[model samples]
Target: MSTYFAILTQVGEAKLANAIALGQTLKLKKMGVGDGNGALPIPDRLQKALVHEVRRADLNQLAIDPANASQIIVEQVLPEDVGGWWLREIGIYDEAGDLCAVANCPPSYKPLMVEGSGRTQVVRVVLIVASTAAIELKIDPSVVLATRQYADDKAAGAVMAHEAKANPHPQYLSKIDGEAKIAAAIAALVDSSPETLNTLAELAEALGRDPHFATTIADALALKAPLDSPTFTGTPNAPTIPHGDNSARVVNARALAEATQGRAGVQGLSGANHGASPANKFTVSALAVTMRNPATGQAITKYATGALTADVAVVGANGRDQAAVIAGTASVHLHFIFNPATGVTALLWSASADAPTLPAGFSFFAYATTIRYQGANVI
Candidate 1:
């Protein structure tokens, strides 16, 4: 009898087993063979028969079979004298050289150390294939390890993403809610009445209001009328001057005029006496006068109001002191004298001695003479 061996390293062991069972059934039908024992006898062309079985098996049909589910088997052994001692991968194939199944061992499995020899260490993996024939395969530990690491990293990243989604920051949640509220507010405003919001005040009135701003809005509305309707008719009322800490307002023109009437003059000069009556007296005096004598043709003496012995001395030394002169007749021209001691002066136009009377609107006075006195005698 020929020894038959099969090796399978990883998943899909059941697929090969199912193909083997189907091949046996078909062989029995074609050959009309009887099932004498539970196991079938090994045929001389066993490798060829197993190849035909694998070729006839449908992978898709096998996948639906519950018995075809992947089954993992792990075993450890010290392999010796099989080229390199590291077991990287194992594959199952039919003796006709058809691939059936494959398995990859973790490349991290190190070679076992040999005790007495300096040669390479040994590692082992037992691969069993349910098919009737064995297979040959080679694998690189580095390549297998790299592919596994890549898949594990992808899985870990997915897990991290799922965890992050489950938990979010508090502020992030609040910001999302705030944005939603603002969006709602904007939508409401867009849906509100357009005509009612003609001005900013009207818009504010149409919207929700705060109690704290009620008075402010009232004051603003009060100013709004004057600003909108700024036209003034007739004369404007006078502006009121505010007293200490008082608010200003408009006052009537009459009140303003009465308040300002007598306050127009200088502060200190008001009600002062201007001396408008004659009782506020001033002394009057005569000025000295000099005249030219007609016969001698010289300037006469000047007389001023002061202490003097006689009127003859006022006319200078050549003046005639006629104390015993003849009495002035009606035809004789009498001169009116000036007495400096009494501050009295007179002017004569006629010889009439009727108390030295003057004509209407006439007055006697003296004035300082501008002529120089020349020494001459007068009759």
Candidate 2:
């Protein structure tokens, strides 16, 4: 049997018995060490405290002894704590600061670092209690120091818990899962993209590192003319409408110039009149004209050739002299004379209602309008 053993003090026994009877927990709070006056000692149930306490600290850990079901294990880590005393006695204190258990230890001299010898110490006390169910197991982590081995064990346990397949941290991704998603994302990035822009860096470089590239493009497009009804500038040229086909088609400046100055098989009737005049003669078989007589101020309809529509006949050479008419009615004669040098046409009416005389050096053609008496005014 080992001389190292712990026993409940008188006050602790009463408290434990009362806690068990009341179904309450006896919360063990701290563990203390003593020197026993520099001598090894034995524990007693009558003792309320150690012979001489050297250090006291909140309990670091509390657990039931696995090998002894009735034994409650209380532990304290004296991490860089008090020194220069002999650890010959140990004590367990409850929440009320009452000594709950006392035990004797193999005497060990703890030295300060200034003495050139120092070491961290772990102290434990095992109490054989009637019912550990009435003993508190939870501890306040803030009041106690942990051993390196304890910290490492706790860290390993936490990692294993985080890696548990059942439930994981909501914000974290597992390594295997994260790798799969990353690979899938990479595959999608280049699934149908061009080889030059397959990667993020390549795409960024292609866009020239301009943060406002899209806005710049939009602004540039705004400066361009729209396709519909675009306004052009600076002497724009276009295909012109063909001559003699007088449908509504746009004519370019070149087409206008060609028409006015004459092209092959076409007459140039321009304001300058520098081209040849047309040689086709004017012919009329019968003339029907409406006029208001200036003397009577009445509307009159005139018919020439006595309402006979006759086939045209050339009365003179080149048909440019006098027009043929019926012999007896009051008639109006007109000569349409063209001046080829000036591109102008002048109409000369006979002042006596007779055949008009053509002006000198002017090519001419003639047509006649006649007058008859109708009782009602006809327009």
In order, the Cα lDDT scores of the candidates are: 0.32, 0.64
Candidate 2's residue-wise lDDT over 137-202, tens digit each? 557877778878778978998998879856566458778998998899889978979988888898
Q: Which segments of candidate 2 are over 4 A away from where they belong?
A: 137-140, 167-379
Which portions of model 1 miss their true places by more than 4 Å? 1-89, 92-110, 113-152, 159-172, 175-379
Per-residue alpha-carbon lDDT of candidate 1 for residues 1-379, written as tens digits (9 for 90 to 100): 2243233322234444565666631010000111213233332212222212211111110111123323222222222322222333333333333433433333322223353333322222233334323122222233222233336867998988877875545555677787998889877876774867745677667655555577777887765437554766766676545333234555554434324331111111111111332121111222344432222223333344332111222221112123332232313122323443443433332323223333322233212211111222112
Count backbone clashes in candidate 1.
2
lDDT of 1 at 306: 34
**Cα misplacement distance, residue 303 of candidate 2 (Å):** 99
What CA RMSD would you report for each candidate?
Answer: 43.4, 34.5
| Candidate topping lDDT | 2
